[model samples]
Target: MSEPRWLTDEEQHVWREFSVATRMLQAHLEGQLQHESNMPHTYYEVLVALSEAPEHRLRMSELADARKSSRSRLSHAVSRLEANGWVRRESCPTDKRGAWAVLTAEGFAAIKAAAPGHVEAVRESLFGPLTAEQVVALGEISTAIREGLSPRCAAAAAAAEAESACAGEVPEESFGVA
Candidate 1:
């Protein structure tokens, strides 16, 4: 095989900028959430996803995939939220072996309390710094990346589900890995 082509200087700079921006943006958002809402961004995402899920519930495996987290991590997180009266897990009635994570009314309230601050933080840290055209460009770029990645992600998710079902367990590495 031939050696991989190196990035050009401009490409390298752009890539570095994107990485830094993403890290900084996450840090900023996390800080905002912690300071204003007493919650972590990841936990908030789980609550939000559950709130939006059908019947305010989703399969544990599916929730892990949606959050790009491992089952263990999600389990731990859900436990924490359950302690806070924000979430609860129930066994799937249709499948005795399956479980579903459900957002409790308290969880819905917490997310509702957190949403305004989160949106304002996002706006302040991101859109406030961008021009309208730049915002549109960012959206286009994000859509392009998602469009390219979604099929691969979906295929991997399906494969994981099938494999787990066949084996009667999720792989140790079944956690979503970016």
Candidate 2:
């Protein structure tokens, strides 16, 4: 086998800093959401995804794919949300084995109430510390990284572009990765 490639000192330093920043940022966001909204970051993401979906509903498999979560995890989360009166599951009329997650009016209210604080927390923790140029660069860097990591995302982008052209509507943001 070929010898393994190793990071140089400078590369190592950059990698370490990137790892720490990612971890800390996630932790801070999760904590802030939990404290302010009484919901975990994942739950907030689910609500956001559903809220943005057409008719405030998405197929369960599509939701799972968007969230990058496994079937079991999504099922459990949906169960919890259902218990909280934020989401309800309905059997797909066309597919007996398929299901859809529908956001309720209560869920809409919950998201509306949570949005301001969540946005403020995100602003304070991320954008507040970065210059405008840095923010734009960060977005570019993030998209590049995501595209590199997930080939499917590139395909999805192309599909979205075609769909957008035909429908005359912009694709909604996918909150699954966040």
Candidate 3:
């Protein structure tokens, strides 16, 4: 095998900056949503996905894909939203295993009430400090990152021991190697 290519100082700096910036942004957004909307950022994302779907409904699988989430996790989130009367589940007639997640009128109202503050929070946290050109650059960078980690690349990464699902403080024995 060829020798491993290690990151230079500049590359390491750039990586750290990008990683910390994303984490900080998510933390800020999460705190804002939890405080103002009484929902976590993940739940808000689900509601937004459902609200944008045709007739405010999507197949459970589609919802999971939209959220980039697994079926079991999405099911748990749906259950929570259903309990809050923000969403309802209906079995699909064509596919017994398939179901639809439907946003209710109350859910629509809840989202509408939540949107203004959420948008403002996003603006303050993300767009407020950036120049117009920087905002454009941010969009390009985000899209590139998303495409780079698409399923094809993800599979290759996993086979290479890339540990895509790990967070900080995980044990090497319990989790995969670094």
Candidate 4:
């Protein structure tokens, strides 16, 4: 293997700034969520993803992928959500071997109740500090990053799916049309 190329000085500075900004943003968001909603950032993300999903439910494996979380981590989170009466795990009728995590009525209620505060927090914590031009720049930057990363991400997801099938942990049919 060859030594990796070093970042240019400007690249290094931008990289460090990006890392710091990401950490600070996450900390601010998580702190606000905990204070106002009694929910962690991760839990809020899980709920957000589910709320946007079809029937407010997603296959457990798909949820894990969408959340960029591991199956075990999502399972534990869902278990906690279940205990809170916000979510429930059910076996998929279409696939006896598969399971789904469905957002409950209570979960929707909780999200509805929390949405205002969360949006306010988001605005105050980040966007409020930015000028309109800055917000546009941020959106452009995010789109670029997403466009650059998406193909590699999709390929990796496909590879992981193939590996899971080979390992007998997930059947290929799991990716079939819902």
Candidate 5:
């Protein structure tokens, strides 16, 4: 194998800070959702995706992709949400193995209830410390890094956009970073 390129001192420092920040933010949000919203952050994201989709539904695979989730992981989450009456699965008539994740009325209401606290948590943990200029810069930096790291990400994004269900713009309330 070829020798790996080593990070410079500054690169190393930036990477460490970025890694820690992402992990800490995720942990903070996860704990907040579990404690205050009575749901995991992952489930909340699923509900939000479905709630935003047309007819409050998306194909199972699409949902998994949107959430960066494995098939089995998404399936497990759907099962848990199903038990909570927050989501339901409907088999596709045209494709036997295909299925849809549909948000129930209860799910919509749950998201509605959970959203305020969730957004607040995000703002507090993520945006509260940043100035407006810093926020914009961070968003740009994040997107540039993401696009650089994953060559197929743009293609996947375009596919999601063509489908139009899984890639809708987040409303201003969600901060629209996505």
Candidate 6:
């Protein structure tokens, strides 16, 4: 194999900062969601994804992909949410092998209640320290990184948009963070 290219000092610094920031941001968001909403960040993400979907539901695989979670992990989280009366699983009508994750009325209410606090927490954790221009830059930077890391996400998103359009529902353009 050819010798691996090493990061220059500036690249190293940037990478380290990005890594640490991601770790810290995740931890902070998890803590905030857990404390205020009685759910972890992952659960919040699942609910948010479902909420943004048509009829507050999505296919299990779609939800798993949207949340960037393993199927098993999503299943477990859905179970927990089900136990809390926040979400329920439904077998897909057309696809025998497929299932759907539906957000319950309680789930909608719960998310509605939790959203403000979650937004505030996110703002505090990420955007509060940044200038307006920096926040704009951050959004661009995040989108670029996300696209680079998961090229398939863009295609999936496009497919979702087409599906939504056909179904007479508008696709959510932004990450449903709450």
Using lDDT as the measure, which candidate wins? Answer: 1
Of the two candidates 1 and 2, the one with more favorable lDDT, higher being better, is: 1
Which scores better on lDDT, 2 or 6?
Answer: 2
What lDDT does the true structure give each of the candidates? 0.86, 0.84, 0.80, 0.84, 0.83, 0.82
Q: What is the per-residue lDDT of model 4 for residues 1-178, given as tens digits with 9 covering 90 to 100?
A: 9999999999999999999988998898888889999999888888999999999999988898899775667777888888899988888787876888899999998888778888998899789989999999999999999899989987987797678768877463342222
lDDT of 6 by residue, 1-178 (tens): 9999999999999999999999999999999888988888888988999999999998877887788875566778888888899998887677666778899999999999989999998899899999999999999998998879786865775686578769985233211211
Q: What is residue 62's positional error in candidate 6, in angstroms?
A: 1.4
RMSD of every candidate to native, in Å, equals 4.2, 8.9, 8.1, 3.6, 9.2, 8.6
Candidate 6 local Cα displacement, residue 111, angstroms: 0.9
Candidate 1 versus the native: TM-score? Answer: 0.84
Clashing pairs in 1: none
Residue-wise lDDT of candidate 2 within 22-92, one digit each (tens)? 89999998998889889988889999999999999998778877897655577779888998999998877
Candidate 3 residue spans exceeding 4 A from truth: 153-178
TM-score of each: 0.84, 0.83, 0.84, 0.83, 0.82, 0.81
Model 3 clashing-pair count: 0
Overall local distance difference test of candidate 1: 0.86
lDDT of 5 by residue, 23-104 (tens): 9999999999999889999999999999999999998878877887755678889889999999988877776657888999
Q: For residue 66, what is the lDDT in candidate 2? A: 88
Which parts of model 6 have CA positions greater than 4 angstroms off?
152-178
Candidate 3 per-residue lDDT over residues 51-134, each given as its tens digit: 999999988767877887755667888888889999998877876656788999988988898899999989998999999999
Q: After superposition, how far is residue 68 of candidate 3 from its true place, in Å?
A: 0.9
lDDT of 1 by residue, 71-166 (tens): 778888888898899988787677766777889999999999999999999999999999999999999999999899989888886787678779
Lowest lDDT block of 10, candidate 1: 169-178
